[model samples]
Target: MENKNKIYIDAIKKIAGSSKLLKDEPMSRHTTFKAGGTADIYIEAENEETVKKTVDFCRLNNIDYYITGNGSNLLVSDDGFRGLILSTAALKDTLEVNGEYLTCSAGYTLAVAANKAAENGLGGMEFASGIPGSVGGAVFMNAGAYGSEIENILQSVRLLEADGTIRTADACELELSYRSSNIGALSRVILRADFKLKKGDKALISEKMAELNLKRRTKQPLDYPSAGSTFKRPDGYFAGALIEKAGLKGFSIGGAQVSEKHCGFVINKGNATSSDIFNLIKHIQKTVLINSGVELTPEIRLVGKF
Candidate 1:
């Protein structure tokens, strides 16, 4: 334990600049669910250089590490992570619009990117108006809504490979599918992305975004703490519908409950632990499987201990 702390501290010092490093930072504050344990080493990298240095240090020291965007779709275990957590939330840079294309950093929020597109009179990102995640995370998951998806607009992505080298790839190489991309399964870290949009009237774009935002507000239980949809949509079926039909809506396990407002979401009512949410998810999965013969797969990424 002493040797581990020493190694972590040495790595932190080797990284350049004011990259903040914390030992055992609480995961609850980082995730949308507001439920998780602690991460052994948490580093907030503010720029590409710092991120590269941090990644290099971790690799050289043979440290276990994982990068996270906004943590909107993540569930960390109550027992906590035993390795480094790299947060790219500070890499918030955007280039000036060039024709119908917009270049943005990975750390930029989807809402921010959507608003930027709207501001520049660019259309096609209206579907992401209310997505509570960073640009990198959205692209990694091929995030979609309201009949539009990242695959429709993403042209290219800048990624940092597992060996600490940066590379660029076209959209075709990403292999995007329903809420997933090849990057999600690979070891590459997203640095930036280029999106292609249509030159549309600003008024029309704003109107469409407003309309979608209103729809999201009306349909989703935004008041509660959740990691959005709890389960992935099964082939030819919706996970929420199955859970609802299984009579699990409003079901509670500790402070975690299947949201009555939207059965697809398992929300933290208040003071919910990671264990509570995990148990609720398992229960819902079991019930849905028994009732409908459909195994519900999770959309939310689960990390840390069981």
Candidate 2:
């Protein structure tokens, strides 16, 4: 523990500015599930400069680190994370719209961006009105809904490479496909994104947003704590349909349960542990694979020591 503290202290000093860093920060507070242990080091980069500096410092020290966007689609384990957790939540910025184009920082939430677009009479992002993730995370996963996706409006993206250099890549280079992107494989950090929208009546856009939001409320289990959809959509079958068919709705393991409202979600029923969620997920997978030949993949990202 002493050695770990010393390493974290050294890394902190190497970074410039008045950046805030926390030691032994509880992961539970940083995740949507509200369950997990502690992180050895937690750093919140308030600006792009701080983000670059911190990344450089970690690289130089051979420190293991990862960036977390809104923590909406993540699950941290019980044993906790020993490395640094970099948060981009403070890097929030949205530029003025020029005609049909808008540039936004990675920290801005998708819902915020959609609202901004609607306010500006832009007509492309109404489908993202209910997405609960940051712009960077949405772009990283190519998040989509209601027959629309980030790839449809995305023009370009600014990214920080592993060696601390920033570069811009065109949308076509991202290779986005149904909740997956090249960013998932590369060790790069998304900084900002450029989106091209269409001109539309503000009232019409607002109506579309309201309709989609209402549909989300009706179909999703929003009353409980969950990391959105629990599993990825299988080839020809929906994960929720399979779970419901298996008679696993309302099934409980510890404090975790399959949401009765939406079988696609595994909710944290007040006091669920990461182990409970993990076990429940495994059981669901096994059952689904046996009952249906299609294997359900996880859309939620899990990290930390098990």
Which predicted model would earn the best lDDT? 1
Please list the C-alpha lDDT of all candidates, in the order they appear.
0.88, 0.86
Q: What are the candidates' C-alpha RMSDs? A: 1.4, 1.6
Off by over 4 Å in 1: 1-3
Q: Look at candidate 1 and give me any clashing residue pairs.
A: none
lDDT of 1 at 262: 92
Model 2 ranges off by over 4 Å? 1-3, 13-16
Q: Which candidate ranks first by TM-score, i.e. highest?
A: 1
* Tens digits of per-residue lDDT for model 1, 192-250: 99999999999999999999999999989999999999888899998888999999989
Error of 1 at 159 (Å): 0.8
**Which residue window of length 10 is worst by lDDT in model 1?**
1-10
